[model samples]
Target: MFARSLGWIVLLGLTLQSVQARDYRYSDAHLHYVDFFQESEGMDALLKAMDQARIDQSMISGVAVAKKWHEDEPKRPRYYAGDDADAYWYSATDIYVAAALEKLEPRQRQRFHPFLTGFNPVDKNAVAHIERMLELYPGLWQGIGEVFTRHDDLTALTSGDTPRANNEAMTRIYHLAAEQDLPVLIHSNITSKRERNPLYLAEIEEPLRNHPHTRFIWAHAGSSMEIHRHQTRLDFLLPTLSRLLESYPNLYIDLSWSVLQPYLLDEQGKPRAQWLALVKRFPERFMLGSDVVGRFDSLSEQLHGFDPFLDALPADVAQKVARDNFLAVLPKQR
Candidate 1:
C-alpha cells in the first residue's frame, strides 16, 4: 500500500510536468515526408525521432493513404511520354534519371513511390489498399496530402485523357478528407522552376475552398531551391506563405527538407537575427515540419527526423515551432 501510494504520487508529478511543458513534441502536424525514401511504417521512425527530441505526439498524413482512397493516383509502374520531350511534367520517366533531368519528367518527378532504388504503387494487387493502410495504422495518420503532384512522365498527369481523369479522382479524394474532417498537408511548392503554381488556378483551389474544414499544408513554403538557397537573409517563402495564409484560414506552412540553409543565409550569405524573426513569426501558422529522412547522419537528416531544425530555434520559439503552434491549429484527431 505504501509503495502503491508512492507510485501514484510519482505518476501524478510526472503527469503534471507533461502538462506543463504542453508536451511540445506532439500536436505537430506538418510532417512533410518522402514516403518514397522512408519505410512504410514511418510512424515508428517518427516516434523514435520525437522521443529523442522529447516530442510527445504528432499529427500525421500520407500520399499512400490519400491515393489508396483516391483511385485516380497514377500507378506506381514506370513508363514514358512520347515526342515533345520538353514537356517532361508528366511525359517521361527514368526513375534513376529524375534528378538528372532538367524538367519534370515522370522519371524525374517526386520519388514518393520511390524513384531512386525502385518504385511501385502501394500494393494494388492486395485487398482494398486504402483499407489496409488505415487498418495497418489507425489513430496515427490524422490526414493526408503533401502528396507531391508528380508523375512517372508528363502524361500520367498531363496526357490528353489521363489528366482529366486524374483531376476528377483527386476531387473525390479531397472530398473524402473533407467528410472525415481531417487536415491535408500537400506537396505544393509555387516557387519551383519545374512546376507551375497550383494555387494560381481556380479548379485546384475549388475543392479546398469548398471544404473549409480541411487543412492544407504546403511542403516547400513556395520557393525554388536555387534562389532561396543562396539568400543572404530573409525568406523568399514569406510572400508565398503569407499570400496563402491570408487567403485561406486553413492554409499552413512546413519547413522540411533543404536543411533550411537558404533561408538561413543573409544578403551577403550570412545568417542573421532578422532571419530568425521571419521564421518565427508564423507560430500557430507554422510547424516544425522536417522531411528529415534516413539518408543523412544527423537526426534532422534521418528519415522522419528534426534535431537539426529544432536546434536552430530559439527556446521560446522552438517550443511553439516544434509543437505548441501546431497543436493550436490542427483539426483535432479523430
Candidate 2:
C-alpha cells in the first residue's frame, strides 16, 4: 500500500511538470500545407489547430515533390510519400499554399509564414522558377524548402534528376535565398535507412561550407521516421551534430517528430543527456517541427513531444527553442 502511494506521487509530480512545460506557447519551425498525394488539408483546419494548441506562428510549405506510384506494386502504401516509385516535382503544390494564405483574414495571415517549394533542386532553371514565384507573390514566401534530397527509397525512385544538396542548381538557389534574406529548410537525409551509415554526409556538409551567408535549417537534423525504424539508436548523431554546430554559425537544426524517439529521448521517454546537453550548448541554434503533412489532428502531440526536454532546460533556453529560435530565423515582414 505504501509503495503504491509512492508511485502515484511520482506520477502526479511528472504530470504537473508536463503541464508547466506546455503552458508556454510555440512557433512551429516546420509545417506542411499539403500532403504527399497533392491534397489540401485546408487552412481552416490548421488555424483551428493552432488556436486550440495556442501556437503563435507556423512556418508552412507544400510538399516539394509528389510521391510516384509504383506500377509493380499490388497495393500502394498509405502514410509515407516514398514508399513506392519516383517522387515527382509537384509545382502546383505551391499554389495550394498560396491559395490557403489568400483564404486567411489579414490578421490571422500574419500568424503563418509560407515557404516556396516544388522546384526541382537539380534543374538549372530552378533558381528562375523561384525568382518568378517571388515576383508573383511579392513578399508572400518567408523561406525556402523542406527541400527533399538524399531521402530514403524516394531517392532510388526519383526520376528526371537525382537531387543533391550541393548540386549546381541548389547552389544557385542558396544564393537566391541569401539575396532574399530567407532561411532555407532542407530535408537531406544523412544516411539511408538500410545502410545506417553516413553515405550522404558530404551532400549537406558542402552546402554548409559554401553558404556562410545563408541560414540553413536542417530538417529532422537529417533524420527520418524510416531511418529511425531501421536503427533506433543514433550513436553517431551527437558527435556529428556537435562538429557541424561548432563549425557553422549559419546552420540550425530542426528537431522534428522523427528525431524525438530514441535520438532525443530514451526508451523510457526521458530526455537523453547528450541531446539535452547539445541543446543547452546551442540554445539559439535549435528548433522544433511537427513535420506534419496535410493534417492538424496530431499537432498537439507533435508540439507536446518536447515538453519533458523543455522542462529540463533553463527557462530562457527553453523559451528560445519553443518559440523564439524559429521566429528569429524567419524573414522579417516587410
Candidate 3:
C-alpha cells in the first residue's frame, strides 16, 4: 500500500512539472546591448544567456547615454539612478553593437536585430547620424531606437534639453525610419509620476498621427519602473492604451518588465482579466521583452514571469505575444 502511494506521488510531481514548463519559444522584443556605463558581458555571454532563456531572437540596441562617474563618489554607482551624475550621449554605443555582431557567425548574427540608438534625439543632426550609420554599415541596422524621450529620471540625468517624441529632431528621425522601413522603439512615459492622467499623450500621439508610415513600438506601454515605484498604478493606463490602439494601426506595445507588476499580473501573480482581454483584442500588436541592460542573469526570469499571464491567454494570442508578434513587426527585408 505504501509503495503504491509513493509511486502515485512521483507521477503527480512529473505531471505538474510538465504542465508548468514553457512550451512556446520567445523573441525578446526589447533588450539593451550595453548598460549605462557603455559596457556589456559581450556577445558570447549574451548568446549563452539567450540560449538558456530560450530567446530565439532579440531586438538589441545600445543605451543612448553613458552615466558619468562623478569625482566625489567613493564607490561607483551600480546603476544610473544611484547618483546625481549626468549621462552624456555616446555615439560609440552603436559601434559596440556592430562590433559584437561582426564577431558572430552569419547564422548567429541573424538571431539579433540591431537597432541604432547612439544619437541625441534632441539634436536635429541626429537623423544625419542615423543615415551615416546606415550608409557606413549597409544591411546592418534593423531598427532605430529604444529612443529615450521623456523617460522618468533618466531625462533629467541626461545632458541636454529634454527630448519629446514629437520634437523637430525626432520628427526628422521618424521620417528617416519610415523611408528605411525600420521600426522605432520609443520610451516616452505617458504621464508624470504624480499625475493620474495621460499628460504626455500628445507628445507620442502627434508623431503617431503625423507619421502614419513609421512603425512605432511604444516601450513599456508608456510606463516605467520609476513611475510604478512612485505610484501604485497608473489608473488611466488601460483605457488610454485601448484608445491609442484603436486610433493608430502603426503603433505596437512592448511588454517589458516595468509593465508586468502593476498592469499585467495582479497581487497574487494571477493574470488580470482586463489586460488579458486587451491583449486578446490586439494580439498582433503586443510583444514580450526582457529589457535587460548589460547583464543577462535575470533574462530568463524576466521573460518567464509573463507565463502566468500568457497561460491565461488563448493559445494563438499567447504564441503571438510570446514570439511571433515581434518577428512580424520587423523590417521585411532585414
Ranking by lDDT: 3, 2, 1
lDDT tens digits, residues 30-97, model 3?
Answer: 99989999999988888899899889999999999999999998889988999999989999999999
C-alpha-based local distance difference test score of model 2: 0.87
Per-residue lDDT for 199-302 in model 2, tens only?
Answer: 78999999999999899999999988878778776677789999999999999999998888878888889988889999999999999898888989889889
The prediction achieving the highest lDDT against the true structure is 3
lDDT of 2 at 248: 96
Query: Model 2: which ten-residue window has the lowest total lDDT?
Result: 77-86
Overall lDDT per candidate, in order of appearance? 0.43, 0.87, 0.93
Order of the predicted models by TM-score, top scorer first: 3, 2, 1
Candidate 2 residue pairs in clash (backbone atoms < 3 Å)? 86-157
Q: Worst ten-residue run, lDDT, model 3? A: 16-25
Q: lDDT score, residue 18, model 3? A: 62
**What lDDT score is found at residue 235 in candidate 1?**
36
